[model samples]
Target: MSAVGANTSPAIGQVHVLADSEKELPVPKRQRLGIAVVSELDSLKASSATKRDRKRQSRKQKQLEKLPEPCSSDDVLWKDIVSVLGGEAIDAAIEDGKDVQAPLVLQEEVELEVKILGSNGDGIAVPVDSKQPWAVVVPLTLPGERVRARIYRHARLHSFGDLVEVVEPSSSLRDMSRVQCKYFGSCGGCQYQMLSYESQLEFKREVVVKAYQNYCTAILEENMPEILATAPSPLQYGYRTKLTPHFDGPSKSVRKGSRKPTTEQPDWLQIGFNRIGTRKVLDIEECPIATSVINAQIAPMRESIIQNSHTYNKGVSLLLRDSLDTSVDESVDRLSDAFNKHICVTEPKSTVREKIGEWVFEYNAGSFFQNNNSVLPPLTDYVRNAIFPPSSTAPSTLTHLVDTYCGAGLFAIVLSPHFEKVAGIELSQDSIRYATHNAKLNHISEDKISFRAGNAGEIFAVVQDFPRDNTAVLIDPPRKGCDEFFIKQLLEFGPKTVVYVSCNVHTQARDVARIVEEGRYRLESVKGFDLFPQTAHVESVAVLRRVD
Candidate 1:
């Protein structure tokens, strides 16, 4: 793994530690995230709890509007003023009649050394010379690089910039590393392609660690629970089990050089992944990250869709799912046929089967299945071992497993054997339907496992019959992470152990920190899974045990 600026110091001033914890290290100001309220806050006609939230947000905004405006004659630094009062308090000081903070104007081309990577994989560079209270975020640039950038617009805490040139490339960029895909720069499907496979693993691990440092106050690096090194996927590229490439209509493709009327050429049917930083779909011929079978069908499918282009009035996303076996070809054929039949239908007319270990899971083509199938075995196995250690049977106290947000019973079925009984709860009826079917398909007795659907708020209510001291709860929420309501419910349920699996580490850190802060559980361990190897995303699992 390449060390970004291994020998060099950060170009910015001294890092300022934020809180009272001795182990809490000073963080770069630019990387500090803040909450922003939307215009939707004006409409608070939803639930009473939502109205209370809106009122609190309104009060916070009003407070920010009350602070004195910065002036050149003032003795205090703008950052110092904001930092002293805290970001939210300062935001509340914004002028009441005006919007939040005034948008910052762009500065001319300037050379800045990239200090660190931001949440979205952008290189963060603080302009030590500028008077503005913002850092420049440049995409397609790496930390430790000196780059000339043109500032676009200043956001709440940082300015967005366009990279002009890498004045001094990072060691990683200067190395023999090369992005494998031809469309690496334009395709939004994958990032971190520029880094070697080993470097990518390290980068992802660092991302998770940094997230915890930023949000989780209870755990410090020295005394923190073990964060096991990321388990690398067996296959990096061509590991994705499914691909959904789409095109917007009026499908128009221009025939080169021929002055033929625009309508004569295929109705500009551009189908593929969205271009990086934009919703525009690039006509991708091949995607190196997608499975081999999915790649094989792209060209023919594009041709077939264009040939019958008249049938499609609106742009549509096509699902190409691989069954991941010797029958992959047949499976692709079936999906392609389904696409042809349901060309306009949003839902595909088929379900695809994926086998992990001895179990085969069949779900709809577009539904959620772990994208990186190669790493799922280890990922699930790790969760099982974390929840049920080898010595777990010694107590004979733990009796059941409760899976919240259980999608199609992946963990419930996998962990069922170790428990007396397992219950899977999901908000989606379709997911519950499939989860139940999956259990039956795997021949798990109905008495041993059951599935429930609708209103996750009641998830714990049904599982309350089981002794809290004998139950383990598995929560795998969506990317935005769990809501406070659910977290409160989980704490109330008071399971013996709570396992949280998240795709977004920042939010995971936030949720996990809150759970720990409740003084009911201690974080046991955290591990990252390279589920999406080439992307800036990591699936992390955090295990917390109830305080004895």
Candidate 2:
């Protein structure tokens, strides 16, 4: 009993340890002392972390600072991304806790991505997920390129964006050449200068088709006819017959803190179009699209205005109209009238007569001639064919013709021979005066060709008393389309045939719908002419026959 008690007591002098993976190794005496020091310092400043922790957080902040700022909260990037990949895919991707950056890149890398479809001066349209449901319209983009973009604005249900990169270049881009003018992209005067002429035609055709389809709910029976059918420009460069230039007083901010005399200073002036996407003036000395004659005269015109600034405090605007006959005497007379009377010289020089069917008409350069001189014969022929088909069985009744919105009696004087008498109604006194002169020049009896100055909408009141049998009306309204009053008047007059000519299809379609619904006019034939090549603008002629 004494031995056993001694052994048990002896065990207290030695330590026995059991192995445990969860337990940490014991620290040395020096390490323990250092930990004790750290704990004491942390307790002294109990609210803040240690210096090591602060250093780690600083490193993280620096890393974040290197990344780009996120787009505005209202941006459409997220919406577009979600749209491209269905909502289920988007939700699943987020739940997977994968890197957010991966989704953006994945969305952009789609095999067949939506692209910018087309552009006018205002904006561009991009195909979204739907074939035609939604379009992403970005300003300043050429069509047919797949682009990675950053959407920064949202409108109604669509979105707007800035092009980041062209993921795939368009065939049109490959053929595109450097713009003829340096200021083309910024001047807002020309939108398709960068595209090849062929590409420009395609672009314009698409614009017409889309506009008619989207805005009018009318189906374009065929893709827009070939660009050649629209009439290519004979002289692509220096073709503009009219030019207007503006001047603003000197920019005082630029002259600040200068000792130069204000009288000798040059004031800021603008002679071209407003800046792209803005009304602010961009000073232009010469315009590439204007004729050389016009450009050559601009400098002197500007100088004259500058010299007379004190005498004429009012700002100045310049207009130069082209005449078909380039006789110096004629040009001088036209210019003198424009300068002295502030009248727009419609005819620059007297040109030979334009013959349509049996009718003939003369025009001056200052007067309005369809800018596409090459296409007018064909276009007018088309109109004539549409109105009076060639057949031996045609009705013998005297076909009376009324030309509303007639300028210089283009349609009226040209088609007068086919009718017993043709009447032309115009708003501009100058135009009416020229129309009268035009009739005299062509040797048409004044009684046969009557020119009246009045509003197109009120024209029916002036011509209502005339016979209506075998009667047809030809109207080429302004880009704003005909007014409701005019449409209503047309309905009441109820001519057998109505030929509606328009430069803007959207407004034209609206008017056409009204005429068809209320006037009982059936759309028989509609055709578009590409008068302004290298631009989205197109001229459309629609024939509507009264429904019996």
The C-alpha TM-scores of every prediction are 0.73, 0.64
What is every candidate's alpha-carbon RMSD to the true fold? 19.2, 16.2
lDDT of every model, 2 decimals: 0.71, 0.59
Report residue 180 deviation for candidate 2 (angstroms): 2.4
Best by lDDT: 1
lDDT of 2 by residue, 1-548 (tens): 23333332223246645348424766323523435455545454653556657887667545432432222122223333334345675455446533132222212422223443342432344443533233354444655566656655433234555555556766646333657787765675776676777766666665455445443443234322222224355556776656666655444554353433233325454545677646766677787776666677766665665555444334455555543332333224433443223222322453533333334444554456565444566677778877887663766464789899898888887777788878888889878887898788667897788988776547777777568767899989877787788888888888888998887765676677678754366777666676765455668777778878
Off by over 4 Å in 2: 1-136, 147-154, 158-167, 218-235, 251-267, 302-315, 324-374, 390-398, 427-430, 454-458
How much RMSD separates candidate 2 from the native structure? 16.2
- Point out where model 1 deviates above 4 Å: 1-108, 127-133, 172-177, 218-223, 251-267, 324-347, 390-396
Q: Write the per-residue lDDT of candidate 1 for residues 345-403, one digit (tens) a residue.
A: 12365666667776767676678878777888898899888877766657557789999
